[model samples]
Target: MDETDQAIVRLLQADGRLGHREIAEIVGLSRSAAAGRINRLIESGQVIVRGVVHPAVLDRNSLAHVGLVVRGPAEPVAALIAAREDCPFVSLTSGPHAIVAELRTSSAHELDEALSGLRGLDGVQGVETLSYIEVLRDVVGPVGETDHRIDDVDAALLHVLQSDGRASYVDLAAHVRLTPAGVRRRVLRLLDAGVVRIGALVRQPGRDGQAAMGIGLRVSGDPRDLLEQLGALPQASFLARTLGRYDLILTLRAYDPAEMLHGLEQVRGLDGVTETVSWTHLRVVKETYAFEGLAP
Candidate 1:
């Protein structure tokens, strides 16, 4: 990605629903040029734009990371796991574990059902599940409670954006029976209210030697203080406090293997971090942030 590409990405990460005109103004590009770059980014499979609902919407939602030790080929196994609706992220890893899957379910029962199906898959030897009790930070936005309530019209707009964050205002207006101006206003309001976050979900290619690691940290100090420190790290994408073998979990992505190692070292060198475990991703099968299915 070039500097302009990076700028466009940052803007979208801040608010995915930004129009081409708005993006162009910030990036100092013509409207068409900005649109072209964004299209290229999306077409190249480097970025995915979508509306991600905050976890607060679903009271009983259960999100977990499952480590699988497969007996045979990991590619096919990862592909199979990626086919399921609940398994948004499935990757073959290069640690003691052969595969890692990020599963999301609306309830505990649904989570159990998904886990059972995963266990039944052939070549799967074992499954180690880590449930996230509180997600301190996610891909595009922080996970927390929502103060504003969404009406049916608001829900419709969000539902559409959940599928396509760059959907045109005219199209959305048609869907919600509002003028183009009305649709734009509503979307801006939703973003300002923190009811939803629109941003790119980047899935870097593992074959290119980009470093992707899952680090579990065991801290010895106050949880809040430790969490604050971890959250500021550049490479950390998904960080959360859990209730299992590890006190915290982090998903890190780097441009190269060296940078990845550097990030790992930085985390280990933190003051309160007592111990750490790392897993390298060999292949990322799926990366999605759409929350349409969980929308209220």
Candidate 2:
């Protein structure tokens, strides 16, 4: 992707519903040219525009990261875990643990059940879980309150958006038997309430001259101050306060290994940080925010 493509991707990442003309104005291209480029990007599988449902929408509020120590080949185990709906983000890492997966569940009981299910999988020797206390930053926009109300019509609209975020208001109105104006109002309400986010999900983004790592920090002093400091870094993608072997967990992306090293060193030098552990993501097996069966 060239600079223009990258800029378009960034714009869509922020708002997937951006019109071709709007993007064209920002990227200094003709409207037709911008539309062509966006179409090409989607057709070539470089970018995907979809609505990411907030966990709060479905009452699936509990979030945790589970690292697994596989007895043998990690791919087979990783594949098995990747197939599970609850484990949305899964990867094979170069570190103490071979596989790491994120589990999204509704309650403590559900989380326990999911962990027990993972323990029963073959080649799973041990499991380490990190429960998120507060998510300072999330890739899918802010994690909003869980009390957002939605009816059957709203769920249907969300389901359609999940498949095609840029679906025209007229098209959406057809799905729910509402007028285009009413449909637009409903969609805007959902977006403004933070119940759903329409954005671009790039596949294998690290292939674009980038390196990513997961860092686990053990902090001694008040973590609030440290969280604010770390969360402000440009490289930080996902940041959270957690309970487990680490107090704070985050993911960083950089242009090269030296830059990654520099970012790591910067984190280490922070005042409250006591110890730090990090793992390089060898491969991301499954990273999805789409919640299936939206209608409830």
Index of the highest-lDDT prediction = 2
Clashing pairs in 2: none
RMSD of each: 2.7, 2.1
Candidate 2 weakest lDDT stretch, 10 residues: 138-147
Residue-by-residue lDDT tens digits, candidate 2, 69-96: 9998999999999999888889899888
Question: Which runs in model 1 stand beyond 4 Å of their true positions?
Answer: 19-32, 58-60, 207-210, 256-258, 291-296
Residue 268 local lDDT, model 2 = 93
- Residues 151-202, candidate 1, lDDT per residue (tens digit)? 7888888888877888889999998889999988998888878778888766
Error of 2 at 187 (Å): 1.3
Worst 10 residues of 1 by lDDT: 287-296
Model 2: how large is the Cα RMSD against the reference?
2.1
Provide the overall lDDT of each model, using Cα atoms, as 2-decimal numbers.
Answer: 0.80, 0.86
Q: By TM-score, who's the top model here?
A: 2
Q: Tell me the lDDT of candidate 2.
A: 0.86
